[model samples]
Target: MNFRNPVRRALVAALGALTVLGASSLHAQEIKERNLRFAFSLAKEHPLGVGAQKFADAVAQKSGGKMKVTLFPNAVLGSDPQNLSAVRGGTLDFTSMATGLVASIDKRFMVFDLPFLFNDAKEAYAIADGPVGKGLLDDLSAHGVIGLGIWDLGFRNMTNSKRPITKAEDLQGLKIRVIASPIFIDLFTTLGANPVPMTFGEVYGALESKAIDGQDNPVAVIESAKFAEVQKYLSLTRHVYTGMPFMMSKKTWDSMSDAERNVIRAAAEEAKQEERKVTAAKEGQSVETLKKSMQVNEVSPAEVARLREKVQPVTDKFSKEVGDATFQQVSAELARLRTASK
Candidate 1:
């Protein structure tokens, strides 16, 4: 019937041609061949490493193989500091490090590193994925990095070659390695332990040689890094919750088309959820694995309360350093979450 009508046939042909042109235009705007390097200071089997690979796979699939994200784990690219500099300079495309290390780039991030700031991952996630966290992340545009989203690293515990830390006083006189950040240094100092600001890569050697008596990190890190071989004690202090801030070089981000950015942002969000799930599941297993080789002990709630009291000064000091407004904002948010839960 259409073949019998030239006008009807022409209308159908025009519509089909327009559809093809539109698709071609959309593809040209959104897809491009790209190779990106993502580096971090953890083994491939670590939760963060697992998340990075998930992100890479999602990116490749989302872009239909137009974009490739290469992962460099275990500090193969460089230490966290070196990688941070490279990312800022645009030589590296992405990296994630402890929020404490990120504090060096912007001290405001120190708010997250405050001792005993978070009781668990649920509270931490609320602070990170909520308004205050997004605001702090948005502020990173000035530092030449695009803050994607915070991935969970879980609560940090203490390990040492010395006796178990049953109370705050037990930590006294221990040479504990800490992230190269002021709050950590002050926190350990206030607790009477000699704080050694060190990079994650140097920690194993330092502990093995007895240069440092102890170090605190999430169980996943301690297990993945095999600290159990050299450290004799594992104290489940859960004193601080560490969040991995996944970021992109602003230069790389600015160069992307809207479509490319969308793919990246979505991939990061999905990978973040996956990372948190894996991290939570692995923590208990890591502790169980560690118990086989280390004298693991749980710090009682009463002692933990005393530990929190001892570090109050350090928290107060950093509350001013990170800016009263930023500090107060987080405190208010935490209060609300706690109240609602009760």
Candidate 2:
């Protein structure tokens, strides 16, 4: 502690600084220069597109331009389900897809597809980003994909070229285009509609050709895909809360060094929040925009009650399918989150 020992003090400080700089240099060297691809079904101007850009920017910053991610929007790499398959087979790098689309690979993902499970985005996030969500993500390792994080896809409402759907019975006899998940098929079928399993790429044409009478998606999707041009009614059923998981292929993830992985994880985490905000902000505007082109109807609370009651059987069936313990725990978590948020 003697200041008079200038030579010794200067040596010590220099050594300490060198040690820190060396560590930083090593970390920086750990990131290998690589370009990557991220695909999603939403249009580039959509929130998912914004999120992908945010993630790509963060990766660039973290890797010092050594890593780059190109965005593929509007199912150019194929539909969500197809891209998911490619990711699993190690042919694709990353994609953000609805949990229901992922549920086709593992039924557990469908647990989020339960109708009326969450009352709002806040409650949904509380359940999804917490332990229940972690477990769901963790289980993906066995399926050859790395589950990065889940973002909000907002609540799904029904849109159709047919009459407006204000009650569960209105869903009856309508051939609705649904994601290629069993739960969607069952959900629509139980409510009396014939569910036609189709990918996002086929929806607009299907609606245009009258191959399907209606489809369900968040308002953002409806607007981005220009569904209003082909469909007449936009029913605010808010039947299912959708979850989007940013995922990477296990092959791509396994090849990355720990430093690279850390940077990507941090970037994804940062981008996730911004993506949710973008999606939420666009939702209101999207709805208003659609109203200008289509007959938009808000399902009455009494009718929503009826829809939930009708879908209870579908819920019970999926609970058993996804395992009673998981279903019960998720329900319990949502209850806790709802009460706490209140």
Candidate 3:
């Protein structure tokens, strides 16, 4: 009898048993885990919500079922500012928030919202994924939030029911609903429109009740939120570049192990890339979708330039409030990107 055959069989049987035992241990661990909650200010069908879900899925898979993330979309917990406060207070674990809202905490964030700063998604991502973006993220850490990465919110457009905004003059006297951000209010006011600062949740009702004659948002957002049904004109202004910052509570982040932090950070970055792709595709199709039900007008390049000129004063005012050094840095970055693109 060859003893080699029996030895090999015994080794194989022991290995199989170890594998089964390890898997059973993992299963037991998963059953005793707690889920993390992610809050965002968009409907479940919106890009941010979709990205949040993707992040949750990645976290759950990467943690091997030991950690999970649940999404609270459409301001379920509160508005952007409120949710951010909750995250800071450790009442909320995570949130995907617009830079506009974050700017209220640190005015430097307004640099990202500069009008006509980023021409397209690629240019935006280039600056955002580089030094400038990292600096902004680091800035948020001082506010009790750990910024993970930047996600796309698409180019901002103008929508109105009073009249088609083909030229700058058309914006005169129209009450446009804007996010509750001073920068946005100043931008619309400088463009001759009366800006009504309101929460995102109240916009649709405001538009429907004629409390606001118009509002501005990305084409994808306008279509997804069905703003077309409440408004008549869609102006391809592309005035502002919006970005959503992925953030976690500093307390929660500090409590996590280094391995867990690394995993969550990696998942957030992957989700950001996915968000940009989804937003780009949705923006390409949204205009056509809106045209089916509403009067859609693509502002000519010359008109966009004219609009830019009209809002220059707003930028000037914001630069003073946001600090000259930061504004200059952002302007320099935009110029460099444009030159390099050409």
lDDT of each: 0.93, 0.90, 0.85
Ranked by lDDT, the better of candidates 2 and 3 is 2
- Clash pairs (backbone) in predicted model 2: none
Q: Candidate 2: worst 10 consecutive residues by lDDT? A: 333-342
Tens-place lDDT per residue, model 3, 119-167, is 7888778777878778888888889999998899988988988778899
Each prediction's RMSD over C-alphas, in Å, is 2.1, 1.5, 3.6
In angstroms, give how far residue 131 of model 1 lies from its true place.
Answer: 1.1
TM-score of 3: 0.90
Candidate 3 ranges with C-alpha deviation above 4 Å: 1-32
- lDDT order of candidates, top first: 1, 2, 3
200, model 3: CA deviation in Å? 0.2
lDDT by residue for model 2 (1-342), tens: 675798989988999999999998999889998989998999988888889999999999989999999999999989888899999989889999999888877788788898888888887787678887888888898999998899888999999988999888888899999888888899999999999998898999999999899999999989989999999999998999999989999999999999999989999999999999998899999999999999999999999998899889988888899888788888888777667766
Q: Write the per-residue lDDT of candidate 1 for residues 1-342, one digit (tens) a residue.
A: 556699989988899999999997797667789999999999989999999999999999988889999999999989999999999999999999998888887888888889999988999999999987898788888999999999988899999998999998898899999998888999999999999998899999999999999999999999999999899999999998898999999999999998899999999999999999999999999999999999999999999999999999999999899999889899999999999999
For model 3, give the 10-residue run with minimal summed lDDT: 25-34
Residue 266's lDDT within candidate 3 is 85
Q: Quick one: best lDDT, which candidate?
A: 1
Candidate 1 runs further than 4 Å off: 1-21
- Model 2 C-alpha lDDT versus the unseen true structure: 0.90
